[model samples]
Target: MALAKPSGLYPCTRSLPQAKTRSFPSLLQPKLHPSPNPSLKPFDATPGLSLVSSSAPVLHLRPRRGFRAPPRASSDPSPLEESPQKDATSEYGLLRRATLVGTATVASKILGLLREIVLAAVIGVGPVATAFNHAAVLPRFSSSFLGGVNGPIHITVATTLSKLSKESRRQLTRKMLNIMFLIGGAFSALTYIYADEIISLTAPGLQVLAQGNLIREMAMNQLKLMTPCILVSGSMAVGFGCLTSEGENTYLALSPSITSIAVIASCAVYILMKGSSSSSLNSPLLGVFISSGASVGSLMQWIIQVMIHKNSERETKFISWMDFFNDKDVHKLFALMLPATLSSGLVQITSLTDLYFSSFIPGAAAGLSYAHLLTMAPLGIFSSTLILPLLPTFSRHTKPSSLASLKENLQKAIVLCMVIILPITCTSCVLAGPVISLLFQRFKFDSSASSFVSSLLLCYSIGSPLWIVRELCAVVFYSLGDGNCPLLINLIAIFMNGILDWLSLSVFGLGAQGLALSTSCVSALSVLALLLLLSNKLGGIINIRDMRGPFLLLLICCAISGFTAMFSYRMLQFFLSTISILRLFGLTELLSILLAGILGMSAFYLPLVFAKFAGVFLVDSLWTTLLNR
Candidate 1:
């Protein structure tokens, strides 16, 4: 699941007043300003107020006083005033917010990792594991694409709500919640009814295996059990968006941990009942428990979000359900939501394609899923902590006069993302085997499984940076009210991804690693295409010529990090080969991993700090702030 980025509706520095001091629910408060000139044409009621018409009458909504817009360039086109101390303070604030979110993300990711580890140990990458992984594709895809914090539904609702008055927000949210619940229910029913057909379509290879009938039956059963999540997940996303719009980010950030914990508890119960021995691992029973746990967890997530919203000062009194259909904002929101939903769906299609291909190779489906979890662990942390907080700033700067600021912010965001992502990519590629071994090489996950997963991880790690870039760039388009661009790009990339997958898997017989490679290649292409189009749209906001220097510097630092990590791991293995103490306690692998990672990061970051490389100031400032805090 992805971290929710702030909708471009509010400035990051602007937050809602305390609930205790408010006369009315904050949901009824309006965040937009009416045009200063009454004679000026009213803007269209499209989400984000993206459509302006001189002849139309603007909505007569009252704007909140004391809410200042972000500063813009002067009429003469002079740059906004900036003092070093003020800039430092602003940077410090951004870093501080990121750290808060990052801390939560780390906790959630650890729990999620534990969930995956438990699943791997209990299930292994066997036929049953592959079946479950395949069965999970649609439910996971729906949850991540439709209901994940950063998914289309959450972003659409948050962005739309940000534009409406508090009263309007409440009415629209209530109606949206109802509508989503109905939609989710209908979809869930369809999925449950067609579970067998869906599983066969997704994992056709399962029908031809030695125990094909058993795997198919297991997968179909799991899919039916998980189908409820299709609905609950969407509802959860809406609740998440509501909380985010109300400025209750802490709860939203930590909510996924609840789902992880639920899964862990469920897994523990099953293990206790069946015992931990490999022979005692009952695939069908375990699959049923895990799938049911996922559905229940999704429901829990939605319930938690609803409870938080109800208790928030932002909550409003219950209004007539008819108010939902009468609201223009609700219609506008769905209009904007449609394209984003399709775009997200297209992204999921790519995942489906990968699974479809991987199913033909024994254990490839499960192996791919395992590798993905490992790859996503760090990606999730950095993307959530760093890129998420910057989204609203990007949104707030989309006006023509603010394009310069947007350009600067975009460049900085890209550089910062690269600084964090590049080294992880490099280090993971070099240390994929050890990392996989250290985290997952116990119990049923044996050396063969480790080797298979590590190969896939290496491919995923290489393309991880591209994935980050693609996501950030897509957000830029979303903020700019050009959702079609990403949708179109995804459509094209999907075709390319399929072709690559076929060539890699069928022609070359590369199996799961081929699927990973195809995904990475397609992601790289998508990033390039997005950059080119975004550059044209912004009248060349990004200059490849200028970015070359920073890109080169990042590459050099990443290379150093990779080499150091690889060298350190080898040295530890060779020197510690004689050390029996670590072996006796089974701490050798763990110690080796920690030492290698620390040394690698030290080698990667120290040079950037000392040499003051491009974008190093972000890390330096964050560190300084951490010390003072």
Candidate 2:
């Protein structure tokens, strides 16, 4: 499961790797994993000036005799010549990406939460925290880099060209495709050339990997192998987004999942090679890196997409790529992507800066990253997953009335994110210690790391909701073909983040955890700025205030759940200490904490269950009602 499908409606869909293109046979090859559920449930906030439901009521009123509930209204645009019809009941395409993607993202976030707890408990907050985070930095940066590289041209070309002449459109697409590929390839080569120098800058000691003198030479090794992904992903974005807008999301959406699969495989392979020797395990330096993963995954993704694009060209005879460069279209593409890169690149640069500063500040090198991982566990769910799948459908609509409809969808997505994440973030902040204990206390992982990481996690959790909000705001603007505004906000926020990082980490002596807190603050500010900027441009294209009450309700519920979780944790601890026969009581107690916390959220949302409110507050239709009203 992944937080919102990062772009696809499911993990299978948002894999991002699907943008990869190879020859025909490989492209046509059957999938290796089970297909994902395209249908999902969504939670929502209320409509303005309307009564809302906490849950559907059991009523005497029933569907017409022999009649089923009317199929759900679709949120995606009515099909155009190039677009596909979304599910009538869907909140997105025919299948409703919001529901499927949101829920899976929620589930994935939950699992990621568990995964992080496990890592924290197992690794502790010291060397391992630094190591895992260090290992993660490149991959995280790469995704952001790719997002930046592709974000501009994607919306610019996709939104604009769909309005262009057919023959002119085809010709332009082929040229853009070729040029983008060549640029991405060049970027990959540059990364290969300077990976070590770059890594050394981020991690001073790891340059030894190039010398083959160290076991896991992290110094410069990590950057060398991983940076290539930014290039591959850049090339793939234009192709995938183009096809997806035309209603071909099956593979393109699922490609990112391949990265996860590859990472897992690489870890498993490394584990086997190393064995379980305590002596060898003592070294945090030896961790799984994904350069090879990128190399292989990129090929897989590229092969499939290349095949699809070429095959489609053969049948349709619609595209031409000769004279790709020096054309007006190339200029337009560059005009679109250039600002996007700088804007998107700002985030990665900040992250890289975080690494730089964190390394210098005592144990911070590891601590800040540890905390970030915990927070990201949820972000991957609520924010990344939803935004990725939503962008295309959203870009397809620019009409004032359509923005109104989509605002409701955004409202629904926001409420759903808060419902799950609010409770989790608050409870995790309160129970950071114990949860970290239960999850990561095995093998080479230790308690110190857990404690430190937990402190940082709590701080980061404060801004959990804002992360998703930022994504929604950016997507809304990007869909409107206004990348420049969001880009500006991202840069400004980066500067603010830098100042805060210095104050929190250096001035306050709050350490890595402080750095995380600073980042969260900046993130919230970015959300505010993005929203205001869009509102100015949109002439009220989007309205987030109507749902403020529901957001408040969700916040209140989260508070109650968190307080209850703390109480449950203490009581469970006491009971377990007293019962010898129930030696496994600790496990049972953890379950109670989780269950109670979940129920607490349910109890808070209970008001939305009634029929009147349900129409506006339910995830999909209810949300639609609320927004429409």
| Candidate with best TM-score | 1
Candidate 1 lDDT tens digits, 23-84: 11111122233333444332233321111111222132223555444465567332222222
Clashes of 2: 66
Question: What's the TM for model 2?
Answer: 0.73
lDDT of 2: 0.55
lDDT of 2 by residue, 1-629 (tens): 00111121222311122222121211112122122443421211222221112332211111234544335458743323233244212433422444454455555455445544444433344443454456556555555345322254554555545555666666666666666766777866876687655555665533332322241244346555665565666557676656645545445445555555565455455557776566544454334333455445655666677788777771123234546445776676567667666776786767766676676554565566556767766666545445555555565556665554455455445555555566567777877777666666666666665577678778888987778777677667766756688778878878888888788766887777777777778888888888777667655433354445544555666666777777766776676657765565546656655665665555545544431232233344534633443
Clashes of each: 5, 66
For model 2, the stretches where C-alpha displacement exceeds 4 angstroms are 1-95, 102-139, 144-174, 203-217, 248-253, 282-291, 304-322, 326-330, 400-409, 541-552, 572-586, 607-616, 620-629
- Per-residue lDDT for 154 in model 2? 54
Model 1 TM-score, 2 decimals: 0.84
Assess every candidate by TM-score. Answer: 0.84, 0.73
Q: What is the C-alpha RMSD of each candidate to the true structure, in Å?
A: 11.7, 12.8
